[model samples]
Target chain A: MAGSLLIELDRVEKTYVQAGVDTRVLRGVSLAVGRGEFVALQGPSGSGKSTLLHILGLLERPTAGRYLLSGEDVSGFADDRLSELRNRHFGFVFQSFYLIPYASALENVLLPGLYGPESRRSLEHRAQELLARVGLADRASFKPSQLSGGQQQRVAIARALINQPAVIFADEPTGQLDSATSAEIMQLLADICTQGASIVMVTHDEETAAFAQRRIRILDGRILDNGGPGPAEG
Target chain B: MRRALRLLPRVAGFALDAVLAYRLRSAFVILAVALGIAALTVIVTSIDGANRKALEIVDMFGHDAVFLLGGDIESRAVGKRTLTLTWDDARTIRQSIPGAYLAVPMRAKSNITARFGSRNFDLPVVVGTTEGYAQVWNWPLSEGRDFTAEDVAHGAKVGLIGDTVAQELFGDRSPVGQIVFLGSLPVQIVGRLSYRGLSGGGGSVDDRIAIPLTTLAQRFNLDRKYFRAIRVKFHNPEFMDAHVENLRSLLRHLHRIAPDQPDDFTILTADQILQFLAMLRGGLVAFLGLTAGGAILVGGFVLANLFSISVAERTTEIGLRKALGAATWAITAQILAEAAMLTLAGALLGMALGMGLGQALSRLGILEIQFSMKVFAIAVASALAIAAIFGLRPARHAAGLDPVQALRRSEG
Candidate 1:
């Protein structure tokens, strides 16, 4: 374990037995994410990029091998304990934004704070600031239904940052956005990285990966290289 | 505890928002609960009122009052349904029965037609009674004087009218001194009887006309010696058991009945009526309780099914919350709280409706209604129990959702 590493995975393997057929999703993948570094994980569809991201985010546990978060062997932790760790140490942003359809933008942003340490008043203030940061201050009361795809993604990013976590796991943050909107979201992620937050993002786009400080490529449930220039062309 | 206290309002607010989101479903839930609560409220008030009415009957009739109802009139193949215990038995009971104050005998006929000038009416009851009839029956006059002993002694053609009959016969104008015909006989109205509403038999208590016993025998061509019933009042009610025995013995002796024979008449007192009413109330309460329980069960089933469907439908949202660090308990509490809020609102609505309906019925004298905190407590407790018993299964289903699987399913 290195002192600079925020997330370290060692020989992690995940297998599913669906309908009595073995489908190994992650094959002994090992990876390390440093503190204050944006690491883009790139692979084509069915390349297990999202599986690796989910394992890093503590959303799923590997069938075999160790997962360490900030130097703690948390692979065997209980669901409740893992949930706490996820809340205190990690955040997530999804491709579809995953904003609560019934909640306003402000409420969506303040959601993580509800499960974290922030008081309601502080959460409110923080939510307001984050909405402003995302340039959706005037639309804070708008619901996810009323927002465009780009705006919804921005709210998701604001929510991800609300808990002030060590790392964020983004599974295709701009997968549904136009190139211009994608560029804007990449710029926001770069800014967040500069402010001392680590990110492990899953994307197939080379340009989306270009925003990261380093790149990792996975194929056929195996990591090809931890520091790849980019995923192999094809 | 402190943390839960803080979370309470948030949980409630979130639940309220979710409920408002699915307005149509929530409305149906509320309606189901409202019906259950309404049934409970009405049942409680109705039973309470029945008990109160039994007490009121005791107060109205007084403990010392007793009525001698003719028995075996139809069973004996009697020609005219004539009284078996005649005027001789009435006299014997008055003379020999201890603590006897008044022994007023009466002859009453039902569905008699009466006319006053051009106005015609079919009166429900026509009572032939002596001078003390008003006092014996606890029917006091509202206006005008009572028929005196002189009127009865002379077999006077005077009628004491109930308020309902008076109103029908004379309108707003007082019926005192107005002459009305009972069949072919003309009788002058002397007194207006107070309105007593309905009897236990559901007949109009205030729709009868009373005339002197002698007048009824002479003018209506009725036998003077036989009366339909004898009503007696005692000096002290505590000795009612002894007087009742004495009266029965004296009546049997006067009728020349053997010791083993069943008396030809039945005795009714305020105490006996109270016992009968108490039994009636117990049966009524049991029936209402079963019915209310069934209603609540059905209502709870509706709620449970709706919430179960809701939980199954909102798996993605629940997963999102879990991903946001909401524990299983937190999700369950929120669901249960939503259910409680719904039932509470419906219970309050039902209480309001029940109170309004109960008050209206009471005011109309259709039924007496009573309320107490016990009723409210039962209603609320039932609603909460229904919510909890029914809400738990769905909440558990929600709590059992896996975030990753739930999110993926939603996405797919």
Candidate 2:
């Protein structure tokens, strides 16, 4: 499945300098995600899982090593070019369901499209479609505060799909939800994966990681094990 | 550039949402800016009114006329009377000065009571002058005839009453051919002067009566040897300044004053009155202009501080926006758009407030405020400039925030 890889990381390294002390977050991390593949990064606290996700999602640049998206090296891209690529190709869902507190669910879903090439009139229609797909079409005009934890996460998922990105990067999408709601969110993510969009999710729970076909475990700043490939990784 | 243009409306909508979300903070900025803009508008409009009034005064006091007033105007104490000017001086200026077309000597008294057929009113002013007084002052009678030189030579009791006196003393009846007693003497009304609304000094210009100079001297018990002032009209108003200087030297020569001694009379022109008005306006401008500047500065300072605090408070939001693929320039543009919109609203409110006061002052006859599109343009441009100057720092700070660190801080 690596023959049609959507993303590739070759010895990526990230370092943070704080108070004259260097903290290595990701060291010599090499990974790849095939098109439509579901991958879960599992690690304990301080395992640098979130940092790796951020670098993969283009929110931050690695200190060294090459990052390839669609077989093209993008590690040396400028800030604006990187922003353009992220807008066109990547989506993110944070742990806190980071919807604009003042905006409605539909408005939150339309945010990504606002920065993309689509016109707002067309984006509105697509945002409604995405919200309906997430099964909260009736709550389109509700603010984030008015929704429950599971409902808010669903809205966040709808927003992540607004721009029709090639890959979705979700950082602990259900970390704050109960077991039952967490299972529901995982099922929704699984359903989305089946629709031909790759997903890279970070979680500490084994049950959550079970939803993904491949699980990559990390400790300290290095990958402990890249879980054996699933049937799609052939 | 094209992408930024397309994203402008979305960014502006985001900005408006933030502004609406924090209503209290937004109102604080709007109120501060509105007060400043209102004060500035009032001051600017008032200055415009003062300029218009000055022009009206110059227009009323005939552009080509030079008034030679009795008493040392530069040195005299207020209300102290002088009687050095005479008809002889008027004769000399009209005969000697090359450009002098006609010089009309005048004597005036205020608070005179006139009576006619049991109706009486306290007239504001009564003037006594020669036959050329009507022509030199450019005041044509609306009805009847002007008094001739023969009337002045004979000290005739005929006079021209102003519209106010005619209306007050005779109702709808014709004032001509009627006799109105001036104090204790009966004077015949020969004509009615035209209606003139208000004087530059804000008193009714139509409240005065005109009579022969000799009649005032004999009937009013004034000294026949001297008069109050002499108004000299020049043929060429373009060269009136030179004519005024020539008249001043000639008056000094005729009065036989030594070069060291100041003349007891003052020469006045429309320019002198306008200069006096400008000096008065200058004091008002300095005081009011400083006040306006201080208000604007305080308003800008408050806006800048509040924006900085808002940016600091929304760190997580900014991070989320960046994560959602918003560029650095988009964040900056959103903050700037918020500032511009708030100030624009404030400018409109301020204009309405100031114009309200302008209408009141205009009604009170204190000033005549000129309402024009220029004022609107100035207010808007200044508000946008303030938004640019004060809103830049906070917008840049928000745009420069590190997304990863911002998100981490919020996670706690």
Tens-digit lDDT string for candidate 2 (B1-412) = 9999999999999999999998887898888888788877878898988888788778778899988898888999777567878778889988999989889999987778999978888877789888877778777788888889899999999999989889999888899989998888788988898886655552677888888999998887899989989988998899987998898898888878799987778888999999999999999889878987888888889889999999988999998888888899999999999999888888888788878878897788776677678778888887897788899999999998888888889888
CAPRI verdict (incorrect, acceptable, medium, high) for model 2: medium
lDDT of 1 by residue, B1-412 (tens): 5655666667677788888887877887888888788778878998888877677677777888888877743245446344776777777777778789788889887777889888887887789888788888777899887778898889999999988888887889989999999998899999999987645563667878899988888887787778888999999989889888888777777778798877777788898888889888888778877877887888899899999988878888888888877766778888998898888887888777777777887778765677789878987888799889999999888888888888888888
Best model per lDDT? 2
The TM-scores, one per candidate, come to 0.86, 0.92
DockQ of 1: 0.44
- lDDT of residue B142 for candidate 1: 92
lDDT tens digits, residues A1-234, model 2? Answer: 335788888888889999999999988888888889899999998999999999999989999988898889999998767888888888888889988898999999998899887999899998999889989999999999999999999999988998898999999988999999999999999999999999999998889999999899899888888886532221
Mark the regions of model 2 whose C-alpha exceeds 4 Å error after superposition: A1-3, A229-234, B75-82, B113-124, B164-187, B217-221
In terms of docking quality, model 1 is: acceptable
> Clashing residue pairs in candidate 2, if any?
none
Model 2 gets an lDDT of 0.87
Q: Each candidate's fnat, in order?
A: 0.35, 0.57
